[model samples]
Target chain A: MPETPTIPDSPATAPLLRLSGLEQVFDTKRGKVPAVSGVDLKVEAGKVLCLVGESGCGKTTTARAAAGLTRPTGGSVEYLGHDIHRMGAAEWQEYREAVQYIHQDPYASLNPVRTVLSSLTAGLRKHKKVKGRHEARQAAARLLEQVELTPAESYLDKYPHQLSGGQRQRVAVARALAMNPKLLIADESTSMLDVSIRVSLLNTLGGLRDDLGVGFMFITHDLAVAKYFAWDGEIAVMYLGKVVEHGPTPQVINDPQHPYTKALIAAVCEPDPRLARSKKTIPLRSAEIPSLTALPSGCTFHPRCPLAESGDCDTTPPTLAPLDERRRLACHVVARDHVAAQAGTG
Target chain B: MSEEPILSVRDLRITYQTGRNSEVVAARDVEFDLYPGQSMALVGESGCGKTTLGLGLLRLLPKLGRIPQGEIVYRRKDGTTADILKMGKEELRRFRWSEAAMVFQGAMNAFNPVQRIGAHFADTLKDHLPEGKRLSKTEIRERSEELLRMVRLEPGRVLPSFPHELSGGMKQRALIALALALNPQVLVLDEPTTALDLLTQCSIVEELHRLRAEFGFTMIFITHDLGLAAELADRVSTMYAGRIIETGTAEDIFYDPRHPYTSGLINAVLPVVGDLPQLASIPGSPPSLATLPAGCAFGPRCEYVQDRCREAVPALEPLTDRPDGLTHATACLRAEDVQHSREVVSRA
Candidate 1:
């Protein structure tokens, strides 16, 4: 087992970003549909909090809400202990500059008509006042260098179409770093790049934690990447729109408490022939994810939960609560089984 | 060991004519054999020509693309073998779905939205059926329902519904069912579950595993994911810059890769077990087929590269160090040194 990454445990130091009971509802033609509901999470300075789930699980919606790209219908997002949604105009502008967002499609996010230097300096000139135009150009070159786009001088003049997918993503990161953000909300940022290039981009993101003291809310559907990149951080497994399990990365991954987490782990395609050929448990619980508009009556996952019982799992919705010092799980069956095992032993 | 292969490819080179005088070598000197009831995986990143190779086997290359050289020998159902690249128009059409079928990449959304789900399968069945053995509508519908049930879907619920009514995973399964409607001897799937959720992908792959055994068909699973390839394929081929850099049994390719490109690919994937190890990413992008280097295509990014490596391209040769009876081959000059270093690192 890998050693768990050391995290900041003291309560005295306030969190960099805190999301309390965050809820988002979209008004469809049918009715009010809930995309995200009653979620709580936090990220300290230079720490990572990975949000993982299948599509339509509200992971992307939550990231957008945190980045202030999409406004939530309920609850508050507190930045540095202040509600960012309720900030004044000047403060809101500053908050926008402090929290940067990196989207999934690097090709679509960048302006195809503009050169690399023009795009970087355009955003930089808007936020910060430079001594002269030459200084802004120099800063743009430095930003490219920071992302390891070598010679920086050659890349400044090239269009986005000329660069490879991985290089284009590096430029996207450089564009975000121009603002010097304290928080980064990356939503599937490395999904478009090749497998060989994803790790390099991940290392670049990892460098930001040590070099710039930036907290990250890394959102992805891939659990292996969630475990590898955020090894020392926290991982929260979301089902439907709620986090079914949240804990330290190693604890949550290795000894997962919730059935959904267990199913996800079992489903991962390991790069081993013996394991693939052997008869292992598949945990193929359901045909597909249930529609969010007409969610199940009790736990959103009960319809697909193999270990779910009749009366309790269908009637009562479980709340996310600490099961042990290491993790928190939102599953009635697991909690009941834990209590029963303790009673039998003690 | 001397039995004829179901499909044999030798020295296959496919090129795309760009303009008046320029050409892009989409695939070059590719070679492999697919035995009956065996699953082979062709893996590489985007633009590495794995898809083009799959298309070449089916003789479905685009207008600009043509096979400049090589032979794709396919064993027909009547126990005779013929080169797929040389078949006439009518013969090619007859050989397409009945002998081999392809489930295209992102085929989940490839359905005609206006048609019912049952109609899609019926259309495929109708097109491929022999002229004298045409089936009635009721029989086609029954066979379609049976195929749907084979993929673990409800025939009653899904048959009457339009393509829009089904979920993405259901649509993908429906496409697979359509591909298997004719019961082709060889089934080629291009990134079948690339964009699906983890559990959904697992279930679909599990279904494929079950069906492959039940139907006894050879499979060609193509994707950029080495992990998914490891799970489904008995033999794996790693492609780089329009050529097969390594080919071996899944166990050999995963545990004891010889080529630097193959090792770099294996090391790049973030393993789900043990400590989070350092990912060794190959530094440069894939070489452009239009302007390839002097020798090895992967030489620019290879860590163990030497002067001779840049001057001479290494052929894919069998490893003598490996035990006899295993067909493990690599296209790297320093394969011995790399294999020894890997053993040392793993042992320590």
Candidate 2:
């Protein structure tokens, strides 16, 4: 039993942002729709905690809840040991300023008519990061350089339409960093960009985490990217708004205890052609993800879980339980298998 | 491999007419062959003309688009080769869905929001069925159901549902099913799985591979994600600024890319294993198609650029230096240098 927990635990050190039993439900024309449910996550300074799942898995909802873009209907989001929703106006403003957001579509997020200089410097001035226009301009140029848009003056005057997709995304990053934010909630920030440019943007983000000590709540459907960018961080695998598995990045990616987690990892096609061709069969049990409006009984993944036993899996919902200090999983079969294997050895 | 290609494109040139009588060379000097049952992935950044090339083959260019020069010689089912670019309107319509069909990018969400899934399938069948071959409503329904099942969707539940009623993955699968309804010999998939989740994309790619094997169809899979392309395609072509810069077998492209652009593309992908290295992004964006740089389009961003590379364009030529002497073509003047070297353009 390997039980080396990577994240430190002590009363003196507190997590930067923590969400406990977070839930977001929308009242649609059909009925109540649970976009997110029973989600728990903790992000410390300088450490990323990526939320990975397919579309409609509530990864975005979780990120929005954490960023205070939308208040969850249930549970609480706490930052620095204080409930974010209950903070005073000044404290709330501080929290809001400290936590910034980067959306998926950089083209849509940026102002098309305004130049990058205005957008980048406006936030800096609003946040009181600079004294005057000249200082703000210099800061904006530095921010652009930080995101690797070289010779900052060259790109400073260009509008969003004038810039390429990659350049626009870099400007978005620069704008986000203008706040000197402690936490960044990026929801599919690079999914819209081309694959080659995506890696570079992720590299810039990883650099920000290292140099500026900014924690990221990176919500994406890309498992490979999450694993690569969050190398020293953690991964939370969600299914239909539930965190099925959460653990250290390597452990979660390598030894996925949950069936859903295993399926997700297996679905990622390796870049090598021989390896991809060798795996002729898809690991998923089914092609369909059950409707979120009418979620399956018990384990939400049971309908597509290969190891799911009919009675137990369809009747009793498995709660996320500790596999070790470093890993957590929510699967009836995995729990049973683990205990069975242990009993056989003992 | 068959001596006769199912489809061959030579000297293909495509340009889009912008405002003020300006023309943008979207695809220039594009050439490749699609063998029976083989999938070719056209990988590139946006505006590299991968989509333009695919659309050109199907002869579905818009009014503003023109193919000033090219020969898209598609081998017909009856052992005849016809230049699709010169085909008449009626001939093209007759050949469109029955011969080569395209599923545009984001086509899953491009369905008619007001129509049910079955209605769309029925519409395609009605529009493209062979002349003098009429099917009853019941027959069309049966065929729609069968097509739906081929893509792993149960028609009983999906046929009557509106597009909005279906999940994103379901919609994408349904689009694939719709594309296969007419039993086309060549399917041009434009980033069909780009917006899809990994699991969904995996299953879709597997289904596509199985379908190609079962039906013996030649497929042109266009995508920006090289990893997905490597998994699905038998051969890969990396495009840059309206040109095919590199063409090789999947293994050759992934393991031993010769073009600096191709190498940069492969290395840009974050490794699933090993420590996260500094990503080597190709610096500087691609030049405008209207006013591309002289010599090589990728010269400005390439790390292995030389004086000769900037003076004249290097034609995509075979790698005669290879031990096996296979036809791994690259358009880089310093192909040997890039082959011997590795990605050194690490972005800090």
Candidate 3:
């Protein structure tokens, strides 16, 4: 059994950001809707903490709340032991400068009319951190250089349209780096991209984390990218606004404990037709995922849970428990006594 | 494997006159056969002529274009062929949906937003079914309900609801239901599930399987995601630049990909299942059709590219030989060498 990770025993030293019981409710037309509930997450000073899930799973909403783009209805988002939601004016500016967001669409997020150099140096100049135009341009060039857009001078004058998809994404990364941020929240950054280019972009991100000890909150739906993404950090898998399963990347991805996680793995396209055939396809359980507006009475996944059909699941959501020394999952089906009794090995 | 195909197209070329001085070769000598009950995927990146090929077959190519070369030979039931390109717009209209139809990429926008989904079914039936021999409005409603039910959506709720009221997946299902209303023998779907989320994508794939079983109609499903293609296609045809570079069974494409471009696509995909595998994405961009290199278009990025690959375009041919004589084909010069080459020394 894997031991629970404590703040002092963190691989990189200590947790830089500690979030617990983050509940976000929105006033929908129907009623007050909880977009995110019972979410606990943490990121160390120089580790990548990927918040991965399907769309409407509240991963993006959680990211928004982290970046201070969305207001949290409840819960605390702590960075270096400071609650960002309740930060003061000057502190908010500091958070804004340190926590940068890289949205999915690189083109739309950027100012089309503005030049790349201007976009890069604008943040530095706005914060009044740099002295003159030449100095800002120098800093911009260095930032672009870090992102591997070598010959940064050539890229500086070009508009977003003048660049390729990969180059445009690089520029977006460079612009975010210009802020000299401590953390980057990339939300579905490469989902709407060509496959060939996506690999190099992921490599570039890994380079940033290693070469520069920048903390990253890398959010994506693709689990495969996470495994070989050069991230040596833990993972958190969200489902319908809750962290259902999470732990070391290897454990969560390879030996997934939760039923939803199992479904996600089984659904992955196998290169070998034989393996794909043998693995039972997680049956198409529902045409539409149960609405977030009116979640099921007990555990959020119970309605879709195959285990629930066996009367093994109920309304009382299971607490996150350690199944092994390195991993933990929040699912009633993975309880030790239940498994031991069923297997007749205890 | 059939005596006659429902849709047989050969060397069909369609070039868009971009401006007075330049012409974009949208599709170059594309050829394929869609037999009854057989589906083929038209896979490629954006601007690779997959859409142009579909439009040319439907006689719905933009006003600035026409089929400049080749024959779009659709073998009809009466043992005759219909030259779709040569047909008049009215004749083409008469054949639309009833004989062949399209289920477009984003079904939400394709649906009439203001109108209910039921009315779309009514409009399709009225437009296609023989005027003299037709079902009543009541019968049409019953059929529309059945179509909605087939896609797993509540017929009653979906029929009365407007497009916006339905989710993207629901709207796509509704659109597919409308397409089936005509009972066409072939479906030309372009990126039907590309726009939806993964959970939704799974359901849509299920819907696609159900659709294939319910109606043994041939399909020319077009998309850029080969992962989705691996799940959906009966036979996969990979398109690059402006041509179909490879064609084979799903197993052949996934396990033993022959084309460099196809392999690159497969390698680039991140493991979608449990903990994701490291994706080894290729590091270059797809070439522009307007200014592709003289020889092999993929030569620039291919690892095993040869000297001849630079000067001569290698037409797609059958794989050299599967030891047990498996059936697969590729359009690359080094396909045989690639087939024999193992992916990696497995640690296990």
Candidate 4:
């Protein structure tokens, strides 16, 4: 599983990760905490984007500024079209081995005294991508049989407290597919498993994004697992750290044009008891989420939205744009009701 | 709703010890009832003993847990009853929080981080008074500012702050206003809106459905979220390697589940509404309550397992008999061939 490094077939034009106007901020002795502010996104190659929101909504600072792990106090992450904070150390070691990440506590991200073949062959023998210890134990048993954890020689000498939070998140997605990465981010990787091992670790990460083309960003706060692993990829949502609804995950989860993505898809909870008592929950005028050092000037969810409008969502902010021709939106009253329903059907 | 029940339980079990001459059973033969304003839920997953049967229904286990065998019974508020494993220590401390209380699964370290949320409501109203009844300090600051303004919080900026100054939905609405300070007629909770934040778990599930329609009590809870047991259950159950295979209502356990581990935890959930269906997941991994499986502790993740499901345990029973008594029940030994192959695959 290592010898496939030829990669630059180029033509499908650039996006194997981009972020743009990203911002991050921090400082915090109770001050400059803007935790991600502009956040545009893209991913392509084997699509999927997800991100969704909630807990201090920055979706882990826009996935640690798209996994160049932090550094974005303001915009730009890019990756394949350069600028991973201005690359060059061999293009920042090919954007750090084609970008990888994974983390959301597979019990505090692996390494409980290592093992699963020394954490999948220590980044394929520190990026030489295998040359010894028998081809790094056959590329760590083909990454524990590509995360299904089959008889990969009974999980190559076990450990991380002998596995099972869905086999330590399939050995943290086989240590992020031993760096053949081309984008993976993950954060909250199957939110600490067990809904029958979170649908077989999301069908082994939707079979590594359809048999290894890979690209994903994924992060989640479970909009039913970002509508089942980005149903045909794309969904954005976020909140105080901006991207209020971007589209195509079945039209941002079936027509959500943002009142905070229809109050996070009407605050979720549906495993069905007549769709959890015939759904419809919207309600928020304030269950209180503000304070990123007192946010709420323009639309940081206009003091708990429910159709906001106090002087156009309290003096401006909206900015996501495009509401149709496949989604986008950020809400000044749903872009004035999609421009008065396209001026009443033109 | 033929009245009477307010907590019943029965052939319970519990156990724990795990050493010198071992011991494990973590909840077994557990039965149930509840009735008075009932809610139920329990659902399973995480070492499914549903928090050791919600801390063995209030005798709150821990210390190598115990319970041992059966009965819980309950029913007090003067219409007497008893059992909670033969009471005593001051009748289980005045029948716990004035007759069944709980709320616990992490309201960020369930209070006492250097007290002050009005001294955890004046030390749970000065150690659950009534024996020489006392209260004072402006009748405990007007009953802890009327239980933090009945969970809408604000009590003069949360009774002089401190449990790390509020938020995680104000310490789960001040731990459901200190588990409704002694107004208990049963509450339990555990994983109450687990680690808050889907709009603070939808305003703490709409402040527990408006505090169970303005205080009607009898709740239970324990979760592993099946969409919060289909949004705050009206009876549900499920549990796995720690026994209860199924029990119903919440539309017979989410539209007729007859336990192939509650239809593989309702087709492994992921439906934030519509399309993208095919799910699967229940293939082995939930047996160990110390090497269980030899008889349906969800027999190796039963996709309708048989061979008399490893020849033994399968009791839960019922399956129908409702006229609103809410029965359903399941356990399974091919629960009528998995409800006749789920009514011939949902009638094709």
Candidate 5:
């Protein structure tokens, strides 16, 4: 039951962004659509935090609200000390400049007719950071070189169509890096590219975090990519626009506390035939996807919980109870270790 | 393993119209044979023509694609060979699904959402079945329920529900049930579980395996996941840029890969759990079909590429002294050298 969550004092390590109980709702014809609800997020300096979920799970809305693009219906996004929901147009522009958002579909993110050089220098010229044409060209070349688009001259002269899918994405990343932003919100940036180029792009993200000390909020549906990208940062698992579970990466993946988390872990494909990892797939059809307009009662995932019965999940939303100092899971099964133990030794 | 071949496709060629003067050779001079009571996999990357080959076997290539150069000889049980390519439109339509059925990857669009799952089976059964063996309503329900049970779903639950009521996996199973309605001579499943998750993928694939075993139907499983292919298929074939680079047993394909593309792919997929040995991948993407190289396609990205490789494209030559040497082939001039290097690496 969500009686009252203890508001703890902030940790000593300076977290760049801290969000608590953020909710984004849309007034649709059917009803109010709560796209993002009760999401608590924390990202530290130089760390890459990944918010992973399937499509339409409110992960995108949370990122938009944090960047001060979408105003929240409830809760607050605390950027250091200031609440982003209360920021004005000028303040929001400053925040938008600082927190750059890189989107999926690099082909669509870039202008079809524009030259790569022009796209890169637009932000620099708009901000009045660079002087004239020669200086802009030099800066553009520098940014392109930083992203490993070799020689820099080859990419600058070409259009989006002239470049490969991977090259186009590199240019997009270069355009984002031009502003020297604080936090990077990459929403499924590499999902559109071919399988072979995904790892190399992720390696670049890892390199950027280490070299520039820029906090990255990398979002993806592929768990394998997420595991490879963010090794140490906490992973926040979202379900129906709520932060269902959040903890250390290794803990949540290896020994998932929540039922939804367990299902996600079980879903990772097992290649080896003799070792049957695919056997325990728990009939995913039971989870009735809640319509955003008509939200489910109590916990959003409660209707689909394999362990849930009639009144247990219908009336109560479990609190994020402390399983340990670094781990917490909001599930009734987790609260009682005895019940989980029986199911654990399967 | 069979003395009698059920379906034999020889020298098949399929190309896509990339531009006004250019054509993308989707499947180039491919050849394979599928017999009864066995499973074969066509594994490759996204645009590698595995699906094209699957559709080609049924003479179902998309618009602007045609089998300009080969014969698909399906030897019927009564000793009559039906050359599918030579068939007219009416003959092609008659033999297509009832003779060899396919289950697509996504089931949402594959099925009519407004119709009940039970109605789909009824349509197929009524169209094919003769009037002499006309069944009652209860008997039809029993048969439909039995089909659902074979795929490990409740017949009543799936029968009454619309397509939207079922999950991705369940809908796929229902499609499988529809495919088996006529009990065709062979079954072709095209990337059947691509969109589904790992667990759901396994459940659906396991159902396919069980059904194939119980019904004793021949299968041509098409997929991109090497690990999934290795698990499901008895024999594996890997394709790259519209060409079959390797065909062998699952062990030979996964444990001992001949093509650089196949090896690179196996090396890249991150293993889910445990202390798996480290994997190395190929650096660059698959080369464009429009501007293919003069010689070998993989030579640009291959570490083992030599001076002779750039001169002439090497044909697939089988290991002479090996068992079923005629059946196994690799398109490399220095197959002996590649084999030797692979063996040394394995030992190390």
Candidate 6:
């Protein structure tokens, strides 16, 4: 057997952000929908934690909770060992400045009426990062250059509509960087971009993680993108408001333990024609995702899971538990397999 | 392999009148031969004219959009040939769902929210029925049910539902069924599996594969996704700035792309199954059609670009010819110099 992968456990410094038992329930007219349930995650400075799942799988809900955008209906969002909801005004302001959010649509995120300079320097001016218009302009130019919108003066006076999708996304990144944020929560930031532009934007974001020591809670539905952006980081696979699998990027991608992770990875259409022809798909029992309001009993993914057993999988819900020293899984079948393997080895 | 092409487009130009005297050429000088039962993928970024070309093929361009100059030679079901651009109003109306149909990009907006799913199919069949043929209500229901079942949707539950009642995948499948209601010889799908979950996309791809095998219809799908193109297309065409920059068999396009833009696009895609490869994005964005550069549209961002590329546009020249007119061609001046190896982009 291959040796277990090891992620450096830095106990010396507190994580930049942590979500402990994070839960979000929306009381719609139809019913109470549990969008995110008991999700635990950690992002240290300069590290990435990618949340990969399909739509309505609670990736966005988890991200919003982590960003302190919405007060969680249950559990707590802690930043630097302090609960975000219980922080004082000074602490809240610091937390707000420390954690920034980059929305999915660049076209809609940036104000169409505001020029690039004004948008970039709005947060800076409000937060007193720059004293005057001259200083703000200089600071904005520097921020734009940091995101690789070079010769920044040319872009300073332009509106959002004048720039291309890729260029507009760079401005969004520049606006986030203006806050000097320690952590950034980017929700499907590159999904709207073309393949070429998407890769370039990912490269720029990866650079920010390394150069500025910024932690990222990147969320996307594209597995290839998650693999590329968070290769050295961790990936948490969410399925219907719960994390089904969590591990190092390479480990989860190459040797997926959870059936959902395996199925998702198998479902991706590789760009190469040879691979496309040779790929083997994991057949699901059902194609439709269960509705959030009417969730299935026990393990939510059990209905579609090919490996799901009759009594245990249907009667009891599985908790996200440590599968190995480096990974966590929430499948009963996989957990049983791990136990059996341990018993045999011992 | 020597069979006649069902759709042969030559020097096709689609333009939109922006002002009194100004017109923007969305697609120009586009030439290709789509053989019967062939699946062709039009791959490009947004605003690259793939959609415009697809719309133009069916004469479905908006009121402002017009086919200024081109010959879209289409072979009818009875083996008669006619130019789609020159078809009379009545002829075009009859030719549209009966000869060729389109599954638009967003299935949500493609459907009417108030109408039941069955009505969409009934309307299509009733409007496109052959001359002097009357269909009973029972016949329409039977046909619509058969179409829905072919796409794996239960007609009993789905037929009575509104567009908002079905999921994105179900809606897409229903739209495909509606498009096939007339049993058109050709189908045009724009971003069929986009905006869907991974598993749903996989099922849709599989469904399309099965449906094509059973129906034996020609297909032309427009998408920005290289992965989907690799999966569904037998022939791949890469478009850049209103022109097909490269055209070839799937193997040639994926394995040995000659155009710098095509190579760059292939290299930019990240694979999920293998080791992470170094990817390099082309430097600049696609140019606006209104103020296109002097010569090659991709010249500004192409690594293999030279002074020759900026002087004049290059025509699509065939590099290798195959059976059924499946020729590997590209419009790059430095086609010979640009290597197809993945290492070229990785090294950059």
Question: Which segments of candidate 6 are over 4 A away from where they belong?
Answer: A1-12, B343-348
Candidate 4 local Cα displacement, residue A172, angstroms: 1.8
Tens digit of per-residue lDDT, candidate 1, span B1-348:
325688989999999999989899999989877778788899889999999999989988889999989999998767899999899887887777888999988856778889998888888888876556688899999999999999989999999999889887888898899889888999999999898888888888888989998998889989988878888988899999999989888888888889988888877887665566667787989888888898898988888989999897789998744322237999999998884222212100
Please name the candidate that would achieve the greatest lDDT relative to the true structure. Answer: 6
- Shift in Å, residue B264, candidate 1: 0.6
Give the winner by DockQ.
6
A1-346: candidate 3 lDDT, tens digit per residue:
1324233243244356666677899897898778899777887767888887777888988988888787788877776667777779998888788888898998788899999988998888888979998898899899888988888899888999988878888898998998878888888888767877888888888888887788888888877666666348877888889888888787777677788887776666544444444546676456467778878766778877766644546657677766667666888767654468768954
Residue-level lDDT of model 2, residues A82-126, one tens digit each, is 778999999998898889999899889999998999999887777
**How far does residue B312 in candidate 5 sit from its true spot (Å)?**
2.7
**In DockQ, how does model 3 score against the reference complex?**
0.46
Model 5, A93-141: lDDT tens digits are: 6767878888888889999989998999999999898999999999999
Candidate 5 residue runs with Cα over 4 Å from true position: A1-14, A276-314, A338-346, B18-22, B111-171, B197-199, B275-279, B319-329, B333-348
TM-score, candidate 6, is 0.97
Pairs in clash, predicted candidate 6: none
TM-score list, all predictions: 0.95, 0.94, 0.91, 0.36, 0.86, 0.97
lDDT of 2 by residue, B202-309 (tens): 878878878888898888889888768878887899899999999888888988898988888877776554455556777777888988898998988888888888
The better candidate by lDDT, 1 or 6, is 6
The whole-model C-alpha lDDT of candidate 2 against the native structure comes to 0.84
- Candidate 1 vs 2: which has more DockQ: 1
> What clash count goes with each model?
0, 0, 15, 1, 0, 0
In candidate 5, clashing pairs total: 0
TM-score, ranked from best to worst: 6, 1, 2, 3, 5, 4
Q: Ten-residue segment with the worst summed lDDT in candidate 3 chain A? A: A1-10
Interface RMSD for each candidate model? 3.4, 4.9, 3.6, 12.2, 5.0, 3.8
**For candidate 6, what is the lDDT?**
0.91
DockQ of candidate 4 relative to the true structure: 0.29
Question: How close is each model in CA RMSD to the real structure?
Answer: 4.0, 4.0, 3.7, 22.3, 4.7, 3.5
